[model samples]
Target: MAGVISGHPLDTLRIRLQQPSSSSSFSALKVLRSMASSEGPLALYKGMSAPLASVAFQNAVVFQVYAVLSRAFDSRNGRDPPSYKSVVLGGVGTGALQSLILCPVELIKIQLQLQKQASRGLGPMGLIRRIMEREGVKGMYRGLAVTALRDAPAHGVYFWTYEYTREHLHPGCRQCEENTTTTLTLGKMLVAGGVAGVASWVCCYPLDVLKSRLQGEPAAYTGILHCFRKSVREEGPAVLWRGLGTAVARAFVVNGAIFSAYEVALRCLSSYQGGQSPSPAAE
Candidate 1:
């Protein structure tokens, strides 16, 4: 929740800048200034409710699924620490499962964030009702296919990088051992999570841009391939990375907070449970 709140402004700008008709000259700072001056400072937090409401549920599902799959893979391989291949497969499973819940939540969030005028004050529930009335249940999942495509490989990279970084950063530390609820310093957790977040985004940002475009109103492109081709042909390849600056910044802050919080919570819970800590490793 804290991470989402901290990074939402950047996400709003990223979504806007990914739009087909968005100006090429728009920077994150420029977008921030424009939104503040034209609307209000609070405008940056538009569409925050949906994400805040769903983030816990979303993360719970992803981590649980990833852990289960990773354990299964490790058992099959008869390995104590799972191979990179197993980690990637677990991540893919996590992403695929999470997408089913994320699609509708994101569809609502993108719509609310992209709204320019206060006159069109459609809250999340209102927008959901409107989508259902106009386009049926499927409308809520406007970009599920692209979302799955983006998330699968992105999460594969995300979890793999996080685990790989944790092991290297804290070499020989029992805390870094798999299936241990060992507490890590906040700094270590931040570094690992930050790298994971940035790697995930950098690897799959273009797909995200396309997914946003397909979900947003006044849809310009027909499908994923058409969106890619049209964007490159008309706007050039640079357009695909329009909001990368803000995204990277957000990744570092939000993911750092996420991992730190996860570690802290696990440690506290373990301490509370008569010093019997469960493994903090998602795997």
Candidate 2:
């Protein structure tokens, strides 16, 4: 869960940058520096608990479901192994399902991070109460549509690119090549994960922008379509790319670490389950 833990702080910063009006009335960089100065390095990590929980649960479920669905697709199709299409579909399904499950926790995390003194005077508890009282249980899923749309395709890119990279990098596919080994080399994993990150970001950026706006400042956006039209009309086309640099950087770091960790973890788990010594090639 290093990704879930370390990444939320950046997630908080991304949210802050995307919705500058939600925080102080300063430029994005200035507000970020101000928060660092005022609240110490730790301040950037507000509302981290929910993400930790969410990511831990999300990764577990996504990985498990992806494996199961991909294998099932392969078995049903009578292919020797699953095709890349199966992997993409599995990733998409896992992402959509996880987004639906994690939306409430995600909404609370964003609301906690974004609530300004002048806006609503709502603390975390107050925000939760207000949402529950006014919008009912469904209010916690405010940005779920955008999240699912973004994640399904984004994850499809991730899985497809990841497998494609591994397949290409390996010498042969018959014996589960070195690239697919549990102890996959750091360099290959980094390259694969980095490419996947770019693939995901490029394909899903518009949806991500919509999700960020919806989560960080709901009032600023009536809905996804309205947000898109208003953004295009008012802020020029570049509005959809707000905070893209930071997002790219965040994705590079976070997704790289996530992929590496996931591969390493899966190797360990698989070895453990098989009652075998850890593969030296894996480490």
Candidate 3:
């Protein structure tokens, strides 16, 4: 939730920057200042509720699916470090499965974020009600294919990179998994997480651009392919890469905090199992 809150404003900016109306001259600072002047600072957090609600479920879905898939190969036990191939496969599966849930959540968020009038502060429930009344059920999952395309390979690369980077940072993590006294190197873990986050976004940002366009302006194009062709023809290939810098930057910060929090929670729970109760509330 903290990660979502902290990164959502930048996310809103990135989405706007990806829109067809934006261009090389549509600077992040300029857009931000425009939003602030037009809609107040809170406009930056316009679509937060849907994604905020999704954080726990999304992470749980990702990690849970990863755990199951990781354990599926070789003679590996629960404590063994998964092979990189297994990591990628697990992440891909996780991403595909999670997209079914995430698609609707993001559809609502995108609509809320792009709304011209933020003065009234439309809530998620209200926005959801409106979409249902007007566009029906299919509207909520408008960009599922594009979402899957963005997430599947991105998540695969993400899990692999995090595992690879963490192993490089602390080669002993695999050996120490079962040790109750073993402590993760906080600095190394955070670095690995940040790098992993950046890797995921860098690998699949163009698909994300399409997903945003498809959802935000569903009537503008037939589908992802149409959206892609139209975006490139009109804006050039470079348009797909727009807002990438903001995305990678946001990914690094938000995912660094998320992974660190996960590790802390895992440690706290492990300690509790050994008859110690440490508060994980700080996380």
lDDT of each: 0.83, 0.73, 0.85
TM-score: model 3 vs. ground truth: 0.93
The Cα error of candidate 1 at residue 100, in Å, is 0.6
Show model 1 residue runs off by greater than 4 Å: 76-79, 173-183, 274-283
Candidate 1 is scored at a TM of 0.90
Report the lDDT of model 3 for residue 210.
94
Please write out the lDDT profile of model 3 over residues 1-283, one tens digit for every residue.
Answer: 9899999999999998999973558778988999999988988998898999888988987888878876675256666778788888888888888899999999989878898863574688987888899989988889999899888999899888988888787777756764545455677668888999999999999999999999888889998889999999998899898899889989999888877777777777877887877544231
Writing each residue's lDDT as its tens digit, candidate 2 over 1-283 gives 6766766666777777666343333345776787777666666777776776667767778889988877776645453556888889888887888888778887888777765533544555677898999999888899988899988888888889878876676534423533334335777677777778878887898788778778877888889998888767766666676667667777877777777777777666666677886564343
lDDT of 3: 0.85
Clashing pairs in 1: none
Winner by lDDT between candidate 3 and candidate 1: 3
- Return the TM-score for each candidate structure: 0.90, 0.85, 0.93
Off by over 4 Å in 2: 20-28, 37-40, 75-79, 117-126, 173-183, 280-283
A best-first ranking of the candidates according to their TM-score comes to 3, 1, 2
